[model samples]
Target: MKRALLALTIVATLATPAYAVLPDEIMADPAKEARARDLSRELRCMVCQNQSIDDSEAPLARDLRLLVRERIAAGDTDAQVIDFLVARYGEFVLLKPRLNSHTWLLWFLTPLAFSVGGIALWRQARRRARTSTERDEALSNLTPDEEARINQLIATEPVSEK
Candidate 1:
């Protein structure tokens, strides 16, 4: 039973999809292969949406991994390979998107929205405070006759004994 469990554990570990880089996709040149791996980590897996091509098992991720290796083997610099993919697939294929005029809103809109909301909330709180103060003042301004009548009613009532 112990031997069978040990064999099962080894098989499960080997079968786990740890990396999407196939053995055949690896380049012969160590330097080029390293560059390809680095580039793959930055490229997004379109099918998976969140995983990098290096970590995704999707067919599109495999295709992208091959493309990166091909580009590196052809002597393209890391920046050139990234630019090529970005041009082909748009900035969506990048795990970290570049900042540009088109993406300014995407980067800045959250803080801008939070600031607007905070200001509105502060103004509302201030208005409520002012209204509350006005209500208190109105309630306290009883007529002199009304005050005397209330005093007489209080004097006429019998006090409860403990």
Candidate 2:
């Protein structure tokens, strides 16, 4: 019964629509079509919430795709089309926002953070190693008899089997 229930749950989950975009609406003009597809990849589908315009079936995505084709057909360059969209919809419409003064930190912070973290980790490891060496030196000062007693105590402990 449990196996049957799990199977049914999996089937139902797979039945749900992952995307609703239809292939028929894609343009056939080679250059313009490529630009349209590229623009679609850059633009976010607002209606679908989390999909790129190319992958979304939302009405807004269809409109945006058509807009891209229209602009490209009108002899607008890809950069111009992107600028127009950014001007009309703000930078939020772009999947990858441009790097500007405000975004400089965002662009560079990942590497900066990793470098800082690496330095901190190295310092901490060095400190630990130094402390461990000091501890070993102190232990070495103990007579050989003391080391033998400590090993014997450890060896006499009971072992637990899993």
In terms of lDDT, which candidate is strongest? Answer: 1
Q: Write the per-residue lDDT of candidate 1 for residues 1-162, one digit (tens) a residue.
A: 999999999999999968888899998888888888888889999999999999998999999999888888788899999999999999999998899987889889999999999999999999999999998897579788877887898999999999
Give the Å error, residue 65, model 2: 0.9
TM-score of each: 0.69, 0.71
Question: What residue runs in model 2 are displaced by over 4 Å at the alpha carbon?
Answer: 1-24, 143-162
Model 1, residue 141: distance off in Å is 3.4
List where candidate 1 sits over 4 angstroms from the true fold: 1-17, 28-34, 143-162
Question: For every candidate structure, what is the RMSD over all alpha carbons to the true structure, in angstroms?
Answer: 7.2, 5.8
lDDT of candidate 1 at residue 143, scale 0 to 100: 89
State the number of backbone clashes in model 1: 0
For this target, which candidate reaches the highest TM-score against the unseen true structure?
2
lDDT of 1 at 130: 100
Q: Judge candidate 2 at residue 84 and give its lDDT.
A: 95
